[model samples]
Target chain A: MKTQRSRGMTPAWAVAALAISAGMMVVTGCHKKTSTPPAAMAPTESAAAPTATISADPLSIDLGQAVVLNWRTTNASSVSIDGIGNVQVNGTQTVSPSSSTNFHLVAKGDGGTTDASVRVTVRVPVTPTAPSGEGDMGSDALFHSHVQDIFFDYDSYELRSDAQASVTAAAAYLNANPNIKVLIGGYCDDRGSAEFNITLGENRANAAKQALVAAGVPAGRIRVVSYGKERQFCTEETESCWQQNRRDQFSIDR
Target chain B: MKASRQGLVFTTFSTLLALSILPAAHGQDWNVLETGKSASASTRLAAADLKPTGGAADEAKHTFDATLYADLASAGLFDLVSKSQNPQATPGSQSEMNLGQWAAAPASAAYVAFGNFAAQNGKIVVNGFLDDAKNAQYPQIFTKLYNQDDSAEGARQAAHEFADDIILRLAGTAGIAETKIFYTKKDGLNKEIWMMDYDGANQHQLTHLGAISIGPRVSPDNSRIAFSTLDKNGFQIKVYSLLLGRIVAFSSVGGTNLSPAWAPSGQQLAFSSSRTGDPEIWVSDPAGSLAHRITSFAGPDVSPTWNPKTGAQIAWVSGRSGLPQIYIMDADGSGVIRLTDGGYASSPSWSPNGQFLAFAWDRKYGPGAPGGQDIYVMEIATKKWIQLTHDIGRCDFPSWSPDGRHVVFANDPDGRAEHTRVMSMLADGTQKRALTGAGADMPNWSWK
Candidate 1:
């Protein structure tokens, strides 16, 4: 064995050395000038742990307008919205707040007690003035306003019985805000074929349109578009990401 | 041979017309060679000599000419010669053709396509002419598109479409635009034959037996199908008439009888069977009344497809060269010659043109994961080849659409379907559309 090894060793070791040198060359070749330390790593290391923040879009909501409250926390083990008798989390529950009601976001973490609250004053949504009719589009046309977010169940286009209340609420808003058209965009999770999902999303959006129109919202005030599973808010391929995908976003036009 | 014959014919015609050089309609001039009586006599005599002449060589040439004319006429692309039999005149000349000849060759119109199939740029190119012979003008320049990718088994489809287009252009009616392919699909643990539209729609199972079924073939009229089904008893050929929607044992022949293809007249089917203790192609009447053996190859000779334009010729895949290769021979199984040279190629489908054969070429590689199956096309004359699919996934059982412009095959689009799904693509291997239904395979394109 030793004799045979020695006979093939010289050339083999040379090839081995060459290969090692080639690999080292590649590694060292990638070295760049040590500029300032990476800004991203430095900020996270020095700053206090990123605490979750919760806030409503509008601090003070006029009775009818929706105050979208959002929350996030790096340390919180579990966090949810509490208080405000009928405060809803879109898919979770329905919210019917009064003057004395406050929306509470209780977040518990390893560091300390952290709580966020939004005092939601419930009132009838206000009616907006009709367009002056000076724009390129007609006042009754769909191009002037937008709808917000709609929701759906897991892998379903059938509007759940629970979703009707949200649809009714949005319809009431549309009824008050005349001359504004809203576009309802339907979406589906990244589960099935894209083509199938596109059809499903379209069906969901149409269902919403049907419900809103039936609820007294002008047919012309609602337009439906299906984005399918295209605009995923979360890139992760997890259940949570999928949950976020089954939704419809509303956008109002001029 | 073509150039020499062209030279001889051209020289002879030119000498006869040397006296007059007045240009005719197009660029060529008509000299009215010996205009008055002698010219008339020459044609009369040529027309009077109707008897087929000479030995095998002359007979073969005459057959080739007749084959070409019949194909062109049926293709609705050429004029047939019904004038008195012109046995004296040489092939390809006006002496044999009377202006008023062949008035009944379908719609009072005849088209002649003359093209040479050759290997070009690593692929086969069949470029020909669509001549409106009666009108004395070129209708269109027809081309049979081919690529090496399809040479494995799709050449027949490419050629069929090329021929169909000739008929469509001249008749203003789609030719063979309705036809279905019958093939076996892997269903669960067993392979079963299934049928579907030419575009891979409305796919349904034709057999539900736990036994294995393979090699389903559609009849010429697209009304019936035949295939081999294996039972504990043994392998047997079964025929299913679409009109009746019933399955029946065909021929009661002992042993395995498979790979049945329809004749042009839809009167007979050419199939391979081991009833004689050796696999060979046999032609049988629809009633299975007359069984004639067409092949006696020592090795396995299967997957036989008959030429629609020539009742006397057939194509089948033979494993004579250690590996399966396609071979074309007389309908009686004479004049056998290997047409393909590659690995594990089988299941040949004849084009309507009688000019090409399509078949599957299964390529095997070393251990880890085997290579995929592909469709290929081959020109009968020049033996040029084109390969069709290259996806890593297994692609098999290609069925040509009725129009012959597309081929439908079964493949797992996701690369890993526990069960296969049917997919189709245009003849050129573009515009692939997957069928939406769940767990589908063994798709046959229906003539409807």
Candidate 2:
């Protein structure tokens, strides 16, 4: 509580700084952060409170198409959006949601908080275009695009024949692109405990990493992480959905 | 010294013989509190308002008086006789209490608490006495005097001390009057670590980690809180020192780390980390040095909770046998034993007395599930279990209170998705009460 930390940080450490800034605010004996106003959230509604509403003509739209979001606040001093930063209390903005996303409109006034949220579900595009950089990618790019995920059986993390084939192809791709470092993110279906899922997911990720290393891909080039059941690939209780969730998805590290 | 020792033994034997020959006092009306049967019929108590005696004693008297009554009622072991139900007696000392009258009639109170609180000359004095109305000859069972600062907080402290004394003598267990609870709350958007009283009062934010912080485990000494938060490293466990009120650096990095459990001695911390390949139980000091893997099983092992009574044993969840089950092992990872055999079980919390374990289990996990997850307590020696909650949507992360008489857990009472409220109940599944509104979860009771 006696000293304040310097908030300056490099780009690589920006997320860490902002995350730890919340803890630093407490350390400096202050509840308010100078960098950010207060954290934004869906404020609990109270009686006779500040009023806000976010409206849209169509709550659903085609992927990559724009939808106008109009907001109105009766007694708000300021308003902020999720992706689009702060805007006028009463204004309009065109948003092209790539996925099912919720736009939270938070209004701050003298009395208290006023918040309204609207979700827009993006319809699947009729014609699927090539993924980014796909049009001009060489074999390395093709390999990068072709790298597949390794799946696991229910409650099992051992690498199977099909998953081992995927890992073999992935290791070949990494061998061609020697400079590309990858991170393996493990995920699980929402079946058991959240805490247990962390370990199961990490073991899945490790199983993938071990396969790639056994196939001659440098172990140093791969890192492992577990999203557990937090970042699910599917939300249904069906076998197909659970199968899709239990896997190791690979990504190139920045 | 030897002659006095023989005389002391003779006096104790004589007193026990005399009490055994006495008739059953209060009959079946009092047997409910003495016998461990139908504990839902809690003990009846009447806390007479403290008589103010000196200058500036009104405010202190009010604070102490309300705090004592609230503590007694919240203990879940007593049916408090409200002020209106009292027999208009302000007995400040043992001589003033009329045992025969209180034992019968409208008051009908089996036990009575009478006290006097005075704040005079910048000092406060509290004199309290417990009277068992059935013991007519020796109605006075206990008395104590406390001297403290003449302040509001001091008054509350005196009440907590006095209530603990009464509970210890009557309930045969230590009271959680002074204990605190460490938990996580989803206030607005930020899920930060928070602390509150054992009775769910005086709640305030303890950590400002704006990221999603979960699984808060306070140290045995109440000096630090160990929880995991998602930062650039993705859910790295952080230790916040309560004394300095700041985050201290941890040596755990390079992978995901979470679910911290402190050994009762406060010397070692056991948590789950994937730093050495896969997530396994890792032990280290609070400063995060001397880290080593204690569980190197093929399957994943996580959520390690140490037996609070002894630092030599640990219990955790393991996915080794197809599905996750509760397992117990030595602190050094030897002498492993699987305590659970079927269904999905996690969040195994060892009771304070080391006689039982409380955990959340589905017991019916599959397609078309039969029942939702509920809290269950298992006896370590006999392997007997009794469900504490049933059909309550989903209840998880059950932690035992400091006295080991009750359990507090997070439940989606309304069956709403992802929303939960804090709840507590007796270990036998009686006297359930909601401790918090929506958006609070993962409650951990403090060590007394």
Give iRMSD, candidate 1: 22.5
lDDT, model 1: 0.51
Ten-residue stretch with the least lDDT total in model 2 chain B: B8-17
Cα TM-score per model: 0.39, 0.69
**lDDT (10s digit) by residue, model 1, range B158-201:** 34455456555654446542244555666665677776534333
- lDDT value, candidate 2, whole model: 0.74
Best by lDDT: 2
* Candidate 1 chain B worst ten-residue window by lDDT: B6-15
Q: Over 4 Å off in model 2, which ranges?
A: A1-144, A148-154, A158-172, A231-247, B1-35, B38-43, B51-67, B79-84, B89-96, B117-127, B136-138, B145-156, B187-190, B414-417
Clashing pairs in 2: none
Across A1-254, the per-residue lDDT of candidate 2 in tens digits comes to 11111212212232223323332233232221111122222244332234566655366666567878777665568889887889998999888765656777777776466566666655543312232331122233554565788788877898989988888888877766564578888888866676888788888988898888888888998888887776677877578988999999887765
Please report the candidate that would top TM-score against the real structure. Answer: 2
Candidate 1 wrong stretches, greater than 4 Å? A1-254, B1-192, B207-210, B363-371, B412-418, B436-439, B446-448
